[model samples]
Target chain A: MTIKQRTFYILRTAIKYVSLLIITFISILPTVSTVITAFKTKEEYGSTNVMTLPKSWTYLSNFVTAWKDANMGLAFRNTFIILVFVLLGSIMFGAMLAYILSRFKFKGNELIRNLFLFATLIPGIATQVTVYQIMHSLGFINTMHGYITLMMGTDVISIYIFIQFFENISLSIDESAIIDGCTYYGVFFKILFPLLKPAIITCMILKGVSTYNEYYMSNLYLQNKSKFVTVSTSLYTFTGPYGNQYNYICAGVIITILPALIIFILSQKQIYSGLTQGAVKG
Target chain B: MGKINTTATKGTILHRLLKWLRSGKGQRTVIMISFMSIPLLLLIIFAYLPFLKMFEFSFYNMKYIGERKFIGFDNYRDVLTDKEVMNSLKLTLYYLLGSFVQLALALYYATMLSFKTKGGSFFKGTIFFPYLISGIAMGFMFRFFYTRGFVLDTVLSWLRFELENLPYWLRDKNVNNMALVATSVWKFMGQNMVLFIGAIMSVDRELYESASLDGANRWYQFRYIILPSIKTIVILNMILSITGSLSAFEPPYVITGGTRGTSTFFLLMHNMAHRHQKVGKASAMALILFGLILMVTIGQKLIFKYGFTDSNEDISQKTTRMLRKQRAKEGKQ
Candidate 1:
């Protein structure tokens, strides 16, 4: 290569590395700063500059105060309950509906598929007013079951994922099962359901993360904040105009994200693939 | 005689019912209904029902609980003429611009990281970690990060910038939206990058090898090979970003509470319904927003379908075919 070409190549490589480093620094700065602030005492937070190292690295008071003041114990419990029921209900119903839609040649199948497709186009926020009214009429407002049911209700994405998975699985399995005296239900539960482990994992990861991160609907529907504080809503404790305690708020933020952070560290591969696949298909 | 006749009729009906239940058609119907009823019901009640009601509510003047007055088009008029609503709609331009920048950055990074790089996974993990964090936490982090003399200012100070010169990120109307948009871009850019990388990785390696053998530089390979291969996914991301920009909420809602000229269309509607108690007007606004989204989506679909007839084929084939045709023409010349 000519000297000009070599020099240009070096310049390009330098630009790439420098830009990547800058972007990485920007990405992690918020979390790192929050971590630092979480460890500082109120006095330290006020006196020292924001990026200053705490006097001691072993301070636990901020976390203790945040947990107790935010009622995060109840929040964690509620979030867990909601997560378990919502995941189970969504997967079971989504898979069952997908099986029928993909495997069966029933009347109105096309209509049902189109309904789901059209439903996805309507943003959920656009329908909140009437949905709230419907919930109130049904006496479901501020109820855990109501929240879970609404969450499990309109998961067109997960259903689509399941349908795509079902399409790839061979029909010969189902045909053989039927010939061996298995009913349709028997074929689904006893034969096909076990084969859906990977799809289930993908759906769980996608649906699980969204449901965990969900705030708007949870806040609106579960209005009894003190009685029903999910992890997302628990942070509101530090949100009033008079409440500007960054130390405790930072600690609460750390507490709120710990589970997700741990999960990401442990299963980074699965998380990346699941997220990419979800986006691509979506 | 009457008792005997009644008994015979009852037995006949029972036998017919049993026969029907044993039939294949009946079994299929039962299975379909049993499996689909709950999901279908939920969808109708939660999604479709509310969607249809938005239209009905748009035509009537009502609160959450009260008598309804049949007022036609007034809510639409009010929504259109409202300065606050119009300003919020205009502010979506900032988010739209942010999203485009986000896509560009994501594409650049994905291109870089798709090839071999030092500590690629570590960089990937660092960038993608923010996407996994909850938006609420991000709101808090950014609210603090942007406060005067805080994380952002401190970092700038390290670079020898004076703290007094820095603007309060969440307070100043001029740069506050930009700050919020930056937070959003930070939070979501990783997901977009991963998506682009996935698309690029799916491209065949031979094309790159051949291009490299022909003395094509990195930019040339990216332009010819990666760009064409990932066109569909890029377009899809663009469409999603456009809709997302229009519905931008969380950052402003959580951090700034839609203050300082930061409210987008969704936030406006949220305040309209919950704060102002103008359910009718909010419904009208929502329906209008929905209509806008639907029009744009259908327009995109049409453009894709008609404008690029052979876009689905591999770009490498198209390039090579064009090259061969050009060579033949030159030979004739």
Candidate 2:
């Protein structure tokens, strides 16, 4: 109610608004800059400042050139194949394994669970030397199937998510089905698989995003870039000493982010919840 | 059943196999094996196998294909003594600082946006958009954004700063890592903010209402109501950020390629393994890095258990008592 208190309140409010605006601007600036740069001609990009608007927004040549030069068509195709197979394979294997681990009172069940728990603690990047060698010995290096197989390896988090979901689904469903002459496989496939839709979506979003955004293994194992260029690797096309073609690079960046951007926009709610759920639960 | 009976008449190997398949235990075993084999095998091959191999490789001096000499602690010694490794490890401090900044910013933003604000969802979407973009694309975006006389310089010039006064962001050793770290913070801060927001939202709304009704300001409400409730997630994010900082790779690897003194421990190990082909040394470095991460994680756990959680419990108890006393006084009135 006092003048001093009123001034302090106004000052605090101003500071809060200013900070929020500044953070938001900082967050969106780079992406916006990339989009603007993508539409610029090479000469225009080189001559003009980065924040300048392009002469014409209809310039589709940079995108076309970036796609052809970066072999992004093949890159996207390869990425799609990897995403489809890896997501399906991970979900099926993760769900089935989670089912067995949660449902069955088998020997070494605790040990298997502990093995997965232990695996989560081991940083994957730290062991790439031996992994690369193992892949090489198995003739998996430079093969799409090899990459897919390696990617299909279920992560502990997804498995835990499935197991958590399975645990919540009462044993009565499986029990009733089995009592009605359903085999164990039938109980799983016919009775339970269809009920795992939420878990499947969460796992799919987690696994699919990682698989789509995966760069390390894809870059490492899939060395035959011309033959196998995932979208992530395709961005490396403009990365040599002589590769300062920002116009083309920005175009490629925009092209690569388009799919993910579209997906995020369409499924913003699911993606946000999925991401937060994974983090919080983990 | 008919086929089994027919095979049983033969009383040979086929009959026994059919007999076993008909048994419940055998069927269960078969089903279990069929379901478990692929995932277990993949786990062993990709996860456990590499880990064990890395441990073994750490003990030998080797290359990708050549004979691995039994060097024992030599690789470990070399890793400890290497100047570049030490320098890169020190560079992790820069990333650690960046992560601290990131956590603070994320906390501030999360607190702000947890409450209703104009266009809050749009701001959330914009902030979180970077987290979804591929790291490779981010590399390209940031590289162009930081280029000399490019996006950053141009924007600064609009604020009366001259392009000539600015340094090449990627090439300057003094600020390149900070630049790289900023990119990482930009990419991840949104996710951290969302997690914080989730934790804050989970707190009881009545607590905030009562606190505000008692004439507490926003800061006091946040301090008393929100902060205590979200302590666990805040700690979790801190631990994640610490470990993440120690293992930073993508930004430096992609945008700067570990140039201009930007390489952290993982990038150095990556370079050592791939570029230099010092697999043995790289393995040692990795094992040491893993050990460091493990030790830090354990230390954090112990600290949280003994130091923060106990004190937090006491504080909550005290607050509850204070609330009870206030309620009693109000009742007397």
Candidate 3:
């Protein structure tokens, strides 16, 4: 390579590296700030030099107070309840719709497919008012069942994914099962269920992430603070009526987010794959 | 034998009724459909039903102040003239624009990674990790990052930037939406990067090899080969990008609450429903926002012919050609 070409390459490499540095800084700055603030005492939190590190760290103390004050232990139990029902309901319904749509060539099949598509697109806010009123009327408001139902019903995306994968499977398996005297229900569980493991897992992870992260519906429907606080709302308890405790809020945030962060790191690949699968297969 | 035969008739009646449920195909359908029913029913009751109620509520002058009275279209008119709602609409448009700018930046950054360069995977992972974090978590994290993040403050000090003089970023109206948008971009960039990388990887390698052989450099090859190959993905991502932007809520909510004096459409809808108890007006606004999303999505489909489908006739032919070439090479060897 000539000197000119080498120079061109150097400049190109420099430009690329610079862009990467800028992007990384943009992404990391906020997280770094949040993590640092967790250590500073209440006074240091509001210091004029907002960019400086705390003169002292009270990591243990801050976390203890945030946890106890926020009642995160109970909040966690509530989250678990919400997770169990939401996960079960979405998978069952998503896979069920997926099974029929994939297997049956019945009338209005396309229309049903379109319905899921349309539901997924209708910015869920559209139904928030109605859902609230109906839940209130039914006396399910501020209850686990109401929140679970709300989360479960808003699962068209999962169904869409399952149906896509279901279409890819060979029909011969179903046909053979039919020949062996199995009914539709028998064939679904006995034959197709085994083949749909990947899609089911995918739906579980996708729905899991969205459900755990969901604050909108829960915030609306789960109004009784003591009875129904999830991780999202639990973090809000740190901002006491008199003033904001920076250390407490910070520690509370880290604790509140730890489960989600752990799940995210562990299943990072699955989460990305699941989202892309929905995008590509949609 | 006659007595035994009489008992068999009762069994036959039960069997006949459940024949479909007994038959493998029909039974499977029933089981699967039943599984779907709870979720779908939940969706119907909570999601679809509420939407219907919103429509019903829109036609009435629902009031907390007095007796409920029917006032068709008046709610919608009230919403239309409401200055707060109009301000929110403007803010939302700005928010949407901010989001798209970030998406474009993400796409560009993603394409750069597709060169199969070093540290590419690490870069992809680092960027993508944020998308997995909840908006609330990240919002709180940013709360500190903006206020007293250690590394950020240290860097600012090192650079001689006065931490003492730094203005509250989230509190100011001028920078409020921008700050939220930057955060949105950070959260979503990784997801978009992964997608763009996938799109780039799916492009025909021979197309790039041939372009390079013809003395076309990286830029030239990217323009002619890479860009065209990923048009469908680009269009799809763009549609998702724009619509998702218009509905931006979480980060802004966590950052400013509904109190920032700056509210997006969804936030306004939320406030209206929960705080104001103007369900009728809120529903109308929600529907209008939905209508806007619907119009844009349909417009995309019409103009770009982009909707989610796995099969692309264009890509299939290319894959076939690659397969044939590989087989021919094997035969020659």
lDDT of 3 by residue, A1-282 (tens): 899999998999889878877787766665555556677777777683555666765446777788888788888899888888888778877777788777777777787777667776667765766766677888878888867776777577778788888888888887887778776777777788788787877888878877777776677777777878887777667545514566677777778667866887677677767777767755
**lDDT-superior candidate, 2 or 3:** 2
Q: Pick the candidate with the highest TM-score.
A: 1
For all predicted structures, in order, the TM-scores are 0.95, 0.93, 0.88
Total clashes, candidate 3? 22
- Model 2 has an lDDT value of 0.86
- Candidate of highest DockQ: 1
Q: What range of 10 consecutive residues in model 2 chain B has the weakest lDDT sum? A: B309-318
Candidate 2 Cα errors over 4 Å, as ranges:
A1-12, B1-27, B300-322, B326-333
Residues A145-246, candidate 2: write the lDDT tens digits: 999999998477788888988999999998898779888899899989999998889889989888999998999999999999999998888886427878
| Residue A119 miss distance in model 1 (angstroms) | 1.5
- Residues B1-333 of candidate 1 have per-residue lDDT tens digits of 999999999999998887876786776778899999999999999999999888899998988888999899999999999999999988889999999999999999999999999999999889988988888888888889988888998999999999778888889888999999999999999989988988898887877776776666788788878898898889878887888988898889888989889888999899989998889999999988888888878987897888665553547688666545655776799
**In model 3, what is the error at residue B115, expressed in angstroms?**
2.8
Q: What are the per-residue Cα lDDT tens digits for candidate 1 across A29-87?
A: 99989988899998998899889988887998999998998899999999999999999
Per-residue lDDT of candidate 3, residues B51-153 (tens digit):
6777778877674346677888988898889988778777766666766776687777887887866787667766777776776777667665655434445
Ranking by TM-score: 1, 2, 3
Docking class of 3: medium
Candidate 2 residue pairs in backbone clash: none
